[model samples]
Each structure stands twice: as structure tokens, then as C-alpha cells.
Target: MVVKTLGKEDLWCGVVGGAALATGGGGAAMPREFFDARVDPLIEKGVKFQIVEPQDIPEDELIFVRLGVGGGIERRMQERCLRRFGVADWIREMDRVFPLPKWAEIPDEEWARVAPYRRLVELKGREPFGFMPFEIGPNVAFEIIRAAMLGKPLIDADNAGYRAVPEVSLGTLNVIHAPITPYVVATSYGDLMVFEKFLSWQRAEDLVRHIAITSGGGCSGMVSFDEDFIKKGTIYGTVSLAMKVGKAILDAREGGDDPVEAILETTGGYRLFEGKVGGTTREGYGAFTWGNIWIKGTGEYAGHTMRIWYKNENQISWIDEEPYVTCPDPFTVVDKKTGLGLSNFRPDHWPVGREVTVWGMKCADLWRTERGLRIYNPKHFGFDIKYVPIEEKVE
Candidate 1:
């Protein structure tokens, strides 16, 4: 078990595979262009990143999971606001209006002396948080950057495995009954609001979404505590898993192998359908994109149809109205040729008649257990069927 360091090359694949793992849910995939514009500068100026295996995490230290919250519809609206208000000036305004807690930079010995005191104040009565991701994405990059800043190790475990769900309650954190309070939400405009308690996952979800909407439709947040509490709850090696999937896709393209096959082979996924985008309709709620998409068959399966229902991530699939695949399992649509994931948020970009491949993979092992199913059963999403694994449902 050797530890691996992730650098420039891995970031590209990490982002690509992490987005695919998001399973058409999660926040919009952070564009490579955006990465170049926003993150490259930080790297150029000496920020570095490395991913440690979860087993390597020191039990004595605290860990935190960080992520972003928002919807595609609101994201679009926020972009318009940014353009009108001016990014630089607006960020400065946000800093003035929403100040974050600041701590002084000091030597390790001095910091160690006060760390327990600081942790005591932060924890109050809450249990320690885990040292992994809730889900991977551009936020993983943000976490890596934060880890670099704090001189802490970023472990490669992620609570959701690779499938991103729409709510905080949908994660391993909730399943394990970990306290998610004492979390911090930092707005794009620089406002930081901390929530020290929540009565329920639903309440926390609503509060986070409300903050995101009012604070310009997006925010970076973190749950911090000691590492011991989340060790069993998290599924390890997910970041490396994403990197492997991404690397396989790139390898396939350059080596003239089938990219889609490469993706399936690398990720142990099965192709559910090969078709064209047929039609789609969506509904926007508090901070989620819920919708159904139709993919009409082509080639060997001509004239057949597949329907997928999504709540951020793809939830259920129907073959001509027959229940096919459902949530707690991953359902993703990718470009047939390039093997790139198509955001459920932008089916319009996928367009009618464009070739796409639908892939299904088992959700994280944690998501398949009794408690996991309790949190993610089809009934939880208002579907009538008892939960079935994707492998069982797919022909």
C-alpha cells in the first residue's frame, strides 16, 4: 500500500472522472476553461495537491469534507448577476458584508498547543467529522487546495462513492447519524455563515439551499471534526477511482480503443442503452433540478425507448414506461464517441438525435446496506417499487 501524489496530470483526469462519478447529479461539471482561469493561477503561485489513502489518515487529527451547493438554473442566473455587478468589485463587497473567521498563521508547535482548545470550541457537544469528500468534483480540487493551505492530508475517501445526490441527507454522513452541524458556508461574495446545529437533514438541506440562493446561488462549505467518527462511514479510494476512469478514457482515445468500453472496463459499469436524445422536461424546486429524459434507441435497438428521471443525478430509468433502473445506484449518460458525461442539467446541449450511451453501475457498497437503502430507496423519491440493485434490474 504505497501512497500516491496527485499533480497536474492527475487533476485533469480527476475532474473528468469525478464529474462522471457525480452521475449527472452534483453541481455542474466545472469546465476545464474555468479551471484554467480560476485554479491554474493558484497552482502557478505554488499551491500543490496530494491525495492520501484513508488508511493513512492520522487518528489524532481532525478532518473535514468540503463541497459546493447550488443548481444549474440558479447558476445561470448567478452568472448574469456577476456580469452585471462586476466580479471583482462584488467579491470585495461580499467580504465587507459577510466576514469569515480568521486565524493567525503560526509555527506548528504553537498551533499544536492551541489546536485542542480550538477544536473544543468548534466541537462543543458534536462528534468529530470525517476526513473525506461527501462527493467529488471541482470541490475536490478546492479541498485539495485547502489541504495544501492548512498543511493537512486530504484522504481519498468520499461518502457518496461517485454518485452525487441532491441532498445532504443522502450521504453516508446522514446514514451513520453523524452530526453535520458546526458546518461553515462561504459565499462567492466572501460571506461566511456557520450553522452549529440542525434538527433534521431536511432542515439542513433547506437552510443550505436558502443560503446558497441568497448568497448568489453558490457557496463553498465544510464540515469539520475529528477523523475517528467517519472512518467506517466513508468508502475509500474514490478519488483514485475517478483518476483511473479518466486515465482510461484518455488512453482509449489516444490508443484507438473504444472509449466507452474503456470506461465500462475501468469502472466495472454496464452499458444500459445506446441511443439518441429524444426529449426532456424538467422542474426546478428550491435548489434541485428534477426531470425526465427520453432516449430513443438506434442501430440494433431501433425504435425502442428509454426514459430516465433525475433529481440532480439520474434516479430512475424506464424502458417504455417499465421500471428499469432506480436510485442508490448510478445512472449516467455519456457521449457515445468521446465518452464524456452529459450533464442532466443541460440536455439541451445534448440535443435531439445526438448519439449517447447510458451506463449503470452499482452505487457504493455503503449505499447498498440496510441503512443506506433506508436513506435512498425508490420510495424515498416517491417511486412505488421496492429497491433493487441496478445489476438486478438491468437485462
Candidate 2:
């Protein structure tokens, strides 16, 4: 099996490229501080960050999908929980135990960050062969970090293709009707719940979202033993795609070329709009960041305006009151000058008067299928517009 070892530069590229494809959700790319504090130390200890293609894994190997439910509200909830739990107290107890005993012995503060996989091993009676991220974005680094910590390589695939979505039902695994149960959910504050069965994907989303709201935010691990299901249900090579896109941006900047143009060329995506952020509004409710970003056109788009509506990720965009682009085709808002994707995880990033560019890429072919559209299209998000392929809309 061929495995690609990642260096610091490769991981940075993954973070930036994943953020661009995140379509304004999936949490911010792993921050520099986080990398310096957590990942850097691991690398110093000779921990290798690695990834493997989906087809390279053995047929009988097990893969676990790790994901998180996050929104602006969840961040606030996290702060509240931290204050209530007392961070100093939690830190003091960190060294009180070593190799925590089984399930409940793990501290609440560390369980969500470290125990999901351990819990999975306990339930499965064997170790997972590799780890898979639920989607692209900072989730790339998240899975990489988890895999590195566990001395395993991450699968170079994601269930959400090149973009992140608000609902669990929107994943390609759901699109392919794969079994998603026997999963584990752990909150930041030490709550753990396991679902051995669920009636439907919608029900699972509901449960997870509610728990996220109540507990600030949390991580979830999904187990699958079937190789056929794993191969068919995920969009392969997305991690590599993110790295490519990121490298293009970096190379462009170093070579004094337009990073935005480099991004378009690398992904074959379209420049949907160029302007300055005119205004923005956002609300955190039902475990989602619901908002709109208005951009006042500039240059060739002068005198016009574009508005983007998002439910966690960019869902639909309108230009001068006409529907311009809509999901499940992924679109993102990026800083026009820097070419970095602006994150919806932080509302301040979209402040008024910031120069920006809006770009979009075609969704994976699976998302355009009748079933994929049913779950991801405008109607699913309560919009009346029909789904239009990004390519068609641009043309």
C-alpha cells in the first residue's frame, strides 16, 4: 500500500485548501496557535502525518468516521461551559489519571478530544485500520491530528466531498444509503452517548444537533466494517485536492501571481462575484449559523450587488435580486487580496467593507443525482429556488 507522508507545509496546504472548499463552514482551518501547540510537538517527537487512498486499504480493515457539529452558538455555549466547569480545575485534574480505565474513567474535558476512538475499539473488539473525516475543511487537520496521535494514517477521502454542509443527512454516505449507526457522540463537557440503532438519517441529525446545542459542541465517531460501503460512500482524494489547491495559492503568492486566479485555475471553479462586503447579518439558532452576506460590486460588477445566504455553509447566492447560484454546488467567499476562504465559524471575518471575491465549483456528480438534490437543494433549506448547476448558472 502506498502511503503519503505529510510535512508541515503539506498540512498547512491542506488547512488552507480545505478552508476554501469548506464553502464558509466546517470550522476554521487549524489555527497557527493550535498547530504550534499540539501538532508541532507531536512532529518533534517523530510522529508522522500520513494519508492513504481509499482503494489502498485492505478489504477487511475497519474505518471510523470522525466529525463535529459546530456553529457560532456552539462556540458561545463552549465558553459558558468552560466558565461553569472552571478551566483551572480541569487542568489540575489532567495528570491525576493515566491510561484512563475504560469508558467513564476518562475526564469529561479530555474525553471528547481523545476517547472516541478508544471507545470505538472497545466496542469493535479490534482496532480501526484508519480514520476518515466526515467532510473537508479544518476537518482535514482534525482527522489528521487524531490519526497522528493514534499512529494511524488518515484516509484521503471525505463523505461531504469538497464542501461542508450543515446536516448529517447531506453526506455522500447518506446519499449512498450506507449504514451510519453504532456511532459514538461525545460532548466537550464529558457527556457520552452511543447509538447502536437509529430509525433514519434525519433522526440522527436531529439528535446530534440537539446534543450539540445543549453541550456547546461535540465530536462524533462512526464505525463501518464493510469495505464495499466505505469505498462507495465517500468522495475519494479530497484531502489531496485540498492540498493541491492550497499549494497553488501558496505558489502563486510566492511567484507574485494572483492567488485568486491560481485558485480558479487549480479547481476549474468560477469567479462568481468581486466586490467589498457591504453588510452582513447572522444568527445562531437550532445549532446553525443562519445568515446573509451582501457584497457591493466592484470593477466589472460595479453598481450591482450580490447576496449569499447560508445555513452553516453557503447555500444560495443572488445577484441583483436574481438567483445566481444555489447548492448543492459549493460556493465560498474569500478575501480578494489574500485568496483565503472566509470562515462562517467566525462572523467578524465578514465585516463590512472587506474586499472579497465569491467563487464556486461544481458539486460532486453524486450530489447532482435526484436523491442528492432532494437532500441538499434549495427546497431542503426552505428556499423556493430550483437547484442550478454552478457551471450552468455561470455559463
Candidate 3:
């Protein structure tokens, strides 16, 4: 049923609408508006995407973008920015400092001041928008800043699921276990600014007050990043999917039907666990987004609970407050309203208070064989998972 074609006309632009929903609440913040003549050319030219695999990629070509802000960091940064620089100029100033893919000039000392404020962008992946939410962790301050020293285009492709959570270690590009700098202590005063990077995610989060005061209640700077990883890991189809999920959900919702029903019909109804979010635990730290999605079911499903956790890089399941859904299983937070799922790369604040919804998880073995498997696999996201489809699971 999966058809591949570009500009093939009325061909059902699945990626188009899909890109929009991937953005979560922050989809509106995209630098460029969707459905414009500018983007049409790319769609027409045949731009193929295969999730984020280093192997399938041509070593020479590259693309990248940091999607979503860490938990509440965006809100704090926004508040601090508005207080000091005002809304109009806040985004403007951020743009000035973190211009797209261009080499920017910075004062060595000034860079130090804002180094910990933020890594400029974040990338997280999950089952959202019919594809995985490829993540870009918020790297540490100057210590691990790659793009800053080299300068890179921070592409506008963060079509992640929701938008909170900020653990830098969840990204695939990183080899070391250490997470990207999760905290940024920023200060700005009119044209004067200072920054300090912190290893602590919460401590850095707490500095919003100080930075707002320091930036004269207004802060601005081009966030720094790692240029190489951006090119290597950042997937290309963000915009394409954001716009489509809505219609997809609408159609699924229109038949007065439940998305869960649709999923069961399409995916063969693989049951992993059913419960409400609990414990406040999460997959791991420094994930583009991380939180414990507690699930305790009512009726027969009661007593048994699950921690649908993620590290922004991959998901690890916990049953009855213990880690059970370990590596390679697919875990996602679906929107109760539309029945659409967002990427795990969503910000940490996403799952908080979002009502008790179902968390669907599929394991690696579900997607191993060449022929489609009914079991859950990464490919169910519309991209290739580590394994192949299992007919037994699906059927």
C-alpha cells in the first residue's frame, strides 16, 4: 500500500501534511510558512528521505536541524526574552545570532556568557507524523559546541511531536554517554550580553530569572551548535509531514471512528500495555524530551502500570515502576483529540497534564524480516525501523 513518488501529481502528499503535525504546539513557530511556492520546487524535484540512517546516506551530502526546545526552557527563554528584548525582537535577535547555516561572528567572551544558555537547537525522534521524530540533542556549552566553532545552517525542520524535555544525550549522533549541556545561564542588557553553560538541566532552568535580569530583562544571541552532526544526522522531510497529519487524523476521526480502531485495523492491533501515566520517571536524561508516561488502567487493566519512557534517543519501557520496554521497542504519545501521535523528540513539558491517553509500543523484533511483519517495528512510523514487519503480529 505504500506508494513512492514525487511530483507524481495528486499522488497523496502524505509527507506534506505529516510534517506540520510533527511540530506539536510549536509548529506555528516555524521560520517559513508551509504550502508556498518556495517549497513546491523541492517536492517537484524528487527529494527522497529515509529517516536518519548514516549508512543509506551518501557520505558527501548532508542535512540537519535541531527540533523542539527542552522542557519549559522555551517558555522560560521566551519569558526572559520578552521581558528584556520584547517579542518582535526576541525572535529577530535569536535569528541574528543563530543565522541559518551561515558562519557568524561572536565575541569570545560573549560566546562564553551564552554558552550554557542553550545549544541553539534540539532534535528528538519518536512515532509521530507517520515517521520517527529524528532528534538533535541540546549539546553542552562551548566544550562540545561543534557548529558554533565551525558554523552551520540550523535548518528549520524541528517537526517534532510535542515541545518540552531537554536531554542532550538522547540523540543518535553522540558516541559518548555524556549528554549535551542541558542548562544555559544567559544574561542580556540591551546590546550587552553574557552567558554561562551548566551541566545541570534543572539548575540551568532555574537561571532564567538571573539571565532575564542580566540581559536587562532582555536577551539575544545566535545559539551555537555542532555543524558536522547537523549535516550527518538531521533528516530532511520535516515540512512535508507537518501539514498532512491533520487531514489524516480528520479522515480517521470523520468516520466517527476512533484512531485506536484505525491503528488496530492497519497494524493488526499489537497489545503491549494499557494504563495511565505515573511515577514522573522518564527514559533518560538530556533527551531532546524525556518524562515518565505513567499508565494505570481501570477494570482488568488496573494494578498493572507502565512507564512509557524515552531518552529522546530511544525508548525504554518500565512495567509496574520498573524498566521493561527496553531498547528497540516503539513508544509514542498519541493526541486524544485527533488520534495522531507526536514524535518522542517533543519537549519535556508535552506529556504533563495531557490527559490519560494510550501509549503504543512496538519492539525491534517486530520489524526484522524483508517481507512485512504484523508486529510493531520502526517502519510503522512510515520510515524503516531497525527490524522488518512481522505478519504474525499484524495479522
Task: Give me the candidate number with maximum TM-score.
Answer: 2
lDDT of 1 at 123: 58
The most accurate candidate by lDDT is 2
How well is each residue in 158-256 modelled by candidate 2, as lDDT tens digits? 888799888888888888888777778876556677888888787888888887776554445455546677788788899999999989988988898
Worst 10 residues of 2 by lDDT: 98-107
Q: Which ten residues in a row have the lowest lDDT in candidate 3?
A: 136-145
Task: Write one digit per residue (lDDT tens) for candidate 1, span 1-395.
Answer: 34566677687787677666667865455667886786678678877677777676666556666645766345555643352364456544445665534651212213322343245446555433224667865356555655665555568887787777777778876777777877676655434566778997667877888776665555557676456655777878888888888788878888988888988898889889999999888776555777888999988767789999888778888888888888888878888887777777775556888898998788888787788888887898888977778888765
> Residue 142: error of model 1 in Å?
4.2
Provide the overall lDDT of each model, using Cα atoms, as 2-decimal numbers.
0.71, 0.81, 0.35
Residue 65, model 2, lDDT: 80
Candidate 2 ranges with C-alpha deviation above 4 Å: 30-33, 74-108, 217-221
Tens-digit per-residue lDDT, 1-395, candidate 3: 13222231211223323322222222212112333333456446544322232223333333332222332224444443443344345645666765534543333434433433333333122111112233311111111122222332123233122121222222332321123332233333223322345554333333443443333332232222333444333334332333233345456777776654444344333445544444364332221234445666645567887665443333444556644433333334455455554444444334544533443333222122232232222333243334422232223
For all predictions, the C-alpha RMSD in Å is 6.1, 4.2, 12.8
Model 3 quality (TM-score):
0.41
Candidate 2 lDDT score at position 129: 83
Can you give the lDDT of residue 118 in candidate 2? 72
- Which candidate model has the greater TM-score, 1 or 2? 2
